[model samples]
Each structure stands twice: as structure tokens, then as C-alpha cells.
Target: MFEQEYESFWKAQVRNASGQRLEMLQRDLTGTKKLLEAVLLPVLGSLDDLILEYEMLSVSGMKIYAVVCLPRLRTVFEEDSFVTHAEKITRDRFSFERVRARSVAILGYTYFPYSRDELEKKASFCQRNLFELIGRVGNVEGTGMNQLPVYEREVLRFAVYNRKPFQLKDVCEWLQLRKEACRQVVRELEFKGLVNAVGGSATRCHKFMISEKAVALLHRS
Candidate 1:
């Protein structure tokens, strides 16, 4: 009964704006808690099933799950097995990097209690910074041999626009480049100090973020 309702709710959400989904959940905290309690808590033991189900959802749906459901089910995720499963999902080439990154970020967010107000404030600040960085980078001089490659520029643009860290696999998938070629470009970016690896690993699954220095340099140019 509730499952049917949940499916309908999700379908309706698919038609709505991403921000609207978050806003709806935030507006009815009690109802959201009840829904999580009734539906999500029962399936906490089946992490694999949950992940697969979520995999079928859109990126916005995934973010909604993270922002709304995960907080209420924090204990389930804190389990070693669930954490392991999430790590595996992060490395899964089949999954979208944005979804994986959101899952990982939500897991981190679950460690402490935070209000909608707090989350919104942080998101706003990050978005502001990301746009500033993107604007500066877009205006950098020389599109020739001295400048960053088109692919690398696309990567920076994607990261800033999405406001999310991304893995090499994400780059390859989005840009339709070979894995090795994407890795080489990422390495070149790192070498030039335009980006930084999150886990300090050059491996494919590791996440990369734009460096503050790159933004500063672009802003100064």
C-alpha cells in the first residue's frame, strides 16, 4: 500500500524541479519522517536492493533520497556493511558520478544533525563560489596551444556547474573519451596545479576537484 504511494510520489517528483522536491520535503518534515519510518526503515537490512532501486532513479531523485531519507535512517548507514556497500557503489563504473558523489556527501552529512536552513546556507555559499570560479576560468586568455585543452576545460566547467567533485570515469562517460586518455588529461591538469585529487590517489575512481589556485590565477588574468 505504502509502496504504491511511494512510487507515485517519486513519479510526481520526477516531473517537478529538483529544488521543488527538496522544498517539499523540507516543508513537511513530519510527513517526511513518517514516510521514512514506514517505508525506509523496513528495508534497512537490504542495502543491495536499496542501492539498485535508487540506481533506477534520476539524479534529482537520488539527491532527494539523500537529503530526506538518509538523515532519518542514519543508523542503518553507519553500519560497516552499508558503508562498504556505499564505497563499492562509489567505484562502480555503471553508476553516475554525480549520484555516487551525492550519496557519499549525504553519508558524511548524516554524521551530525543539521537543519534545512544550515544545508541551504552551505549550498548557497558553494554555488556562489563555484560560479565565480567558472566565470574566471571561462575568461582565461589564449585558446591555443598555451591554453588548457577543450576536454579539460569541459571537465572544469562540468565540475563547477554541477558543484560536485567528479571521478575520471565520469569524465570519460560524459565526454566519450577513452579511460586512459581521460586519465592522462586529468593528470596533466593536476600537474599544472589546476585541480587536486580528493583522496590523493591517481587511480581512476578517486574524485578530483578544482584548485583554489586555478581560480585565483584565472581571476587575476
Candidate 2:
């Protein structure tokens, strides 16, 4: 059996005035747990290897962590039972909401007291703080990035960060490999269904793009 680890921490942050923030924010917990009851339990609790903890993120913010299977490891993005069951909880609870099947060996979500407008403005800062608080959960060396080799992972990382499809010449120069070796690695990635070819004629194909599956698999990392 293949072993794969899923790791992603989700954070909800709170930002407001300087006084009595904790009392105000703690009140939000009731709703938060309502969301978690709607969001976390059924899927996470099912796994026998699981740990759930709460952290004080601020006078106003609290962080929740859930660990399952160390707890449990399964193929990245293809665990349909977990995906289907967990996503249904989110969907039924929130109705076409973006929350879906957010499972991880070290799963964490934060509670923030922010309105939609304020939240949109500070998404990155909030996520950065959560990563800092939890440290990086995905162990790249330990997991092998969905079983990719070093070269493939680097190329995939490049594609993800670049956010676009690129030609073979791009990876060749970036990875500093000869054209032939670059093509080989890209082909292997494509064979694993992790990369795709786009923006080329039938006989003159040359561009490579990262797959959505790989995007979800590595986005947390």
C-alpha cells in the first residue's frame, strides 16, 4: 500500500480595537463551534488516530487543531470517501460554499471576528500568522510530495508559483538541464498525472502546466 500525507492549516483571524477584544471574540465561539459542528466533526472524528486542540491566537483569536492518523496517511486528493463525506458536511452546512473536505494529519482552523470586507483584505497576513503559529505542517522530505522526486517537485513548485503554463525551454533554463533531460522529467510528471501539456499544436507540443490535483496537493505545503 502507498503512503501519502495531507497537511494544511486553515486560519480565521480577528482584528479590531485595542480593548476587551477577548470577551467580544469569545462570544463568537458559539457560532464558530456551530460551524465546526457543521464543519469538522463527522469526517475528522471518524478516523481513530486523531487529536484536536485549541490555542489562544490572540486576545481575540483562537486556533483549533485536529490531527488524525500520524494519525492516518492516504493518497493525496484521491481519498474519495473522506472527500465525499467531508465535502457534503461543508456543502450541506454552508450551501455551495468554498469549504470542502479540508482534511489533514495536522488540520487547523482559526476563529476570527472579522466581517467579509475586512476578511478579504487580510487573508494573506492571516494565513501567514497561522503558518508561523503552527510551523510548516507538510514535511516535504518526509512525504516525497505525492511521491514525486526532487526534480519533479521543484518543477511542479515552479509551475505552481509561476501560475501559468510554460514551454519546455522555460523549465530547461530554470532547472538548468539540457533540453532532453528536461523533457524526460516533464514526461514523467505528466505520466504520473501531475502535469499537463497545453498551448501547442498536435505535432509541435512544447508547453507544460501543473494539474489541479497537484495544485491542491501542494497548495498547503
Task: Report the number of the highest-TM-score candidate.
Answer: 2
How well is each residue in 1-221 modelled by candidate 1, as lDDT tens digits?
Answer: 65565555555544543554535533434433342333333323211222211212433564333333232222112111223344465545435644655655555432212333323345354334435433434544431222667777777666656556888888898689999999988888889887888875445448888776554443232
lDDT value for candidate 1? Answer: 0.48
Give me the displacement of residue 37 in model 2, in angstroms. Answer: 17
Q: List lDDT for all candidates, in order.
A: 0.48, 0.44
Q: Candidate 1, which segments miss by more than 4 Å at Cα? A: 1-126, 129-137, 140-146, 200-205
**What TM-score would candidate 2 get against the native?**
0.43
